[model samples]
Target: MTNINNIQSISQILDSQSTKKSKSSGPAQGFESLLNSVLEKTQESEQGIQATELGEIPAMDFDIQTVSSIVTDKTDKLLTSLESYAYKLDDGNITLKEIEPMLEELNADAASLLEETLSLGEDDQSLIDIARSTAVTAKTEYLKFQRGDYL
Candidate 1:
């Protein structure tokens, strides 16, 4: 009877292990694939933007308001993405690898915006500097979380 009970307990444990593995496997793979796709697209988009090229002042007349609006829209998207990921992190669902790439993308977006803003006339410099500084500080905190040094 004791041998039979031990066998039953072992079977229960094996069943539990298999169940947990099966449950986690699909979601884990999906999350990893999503992260990969986001990273790849972000890198491609950043390359196409070429923030350095924006540094050159074009001879043609430009609308600063239109340019500022576009920059604000991109920055808002980056911030929104980071905020969503932070919620996932708070839930203990985000892995360090996932956080790192996302943080890097956010940093790049902020840097690109700053580069474009700096290319503008001196009148807009102060506001752009403030925005850039805030973004840098936010990115630093994000990096800490990604490194598991802070929450």
Candidate 2:
């Protein structure tokens, strides 16, 4: 499954188990436990592939280069979209229809990147904030355009 699906599954499980959200460490511990389970499942699936003569394909694991690529690619695209939006605003010749699609794309990409970046072992709060804030700004602008505020 994709990283987005994996994150959604983890989020759902964490939500269901968060009866006491004030416990602070509960969520962190739960996340670690859930991640461990996923890794174990991946290992089991890999073993099955080996039994079938696939030569034990490597299982998925968090890789910094992979995460960095995802973050950089997504954020760069979002930045491009933002620049386009600014130009459109300045020209006063662009329509909501023209920019909505790009903003929506940025929103989707940023969300996925944020989730994957968070899965990294080292907590990079600045990257996390950038992803989150950019996504939020994109959504806000999209909604504003939809509401005719940008017309």
- Name the best candidate (by TM-score): 2
lDDT of 2 by residue, 39-99 (tens): 8777887766333442457889975566756776777788788877778777766766776
Give candidate 1's error at residue 28 in angstroms.
76
Global local distance difference test of model 1: 0.70
- Clashes by residue pair, model 2: none
Deviation in angstroms for 60 in model 1? 19
Once fitted onto the true fold, the runs of candidate 1 whose alpha carbons sit more than 4 angstroms away are 1-65, 125-130
Per-candidate local distance difference test: 0.70, 0.72
User: Model 1 reaches what TM-score against the true structure?
Assistant: 0.45
Clashes of 2: 0
TM-score of each candidate structure, all chains considered together: 0.45, 0.48
Writing each residue's lDDT as its tens digit, candidate 1 over 25-91 gives: 5878798889998787767767885545335686988766765666566667766866866776686
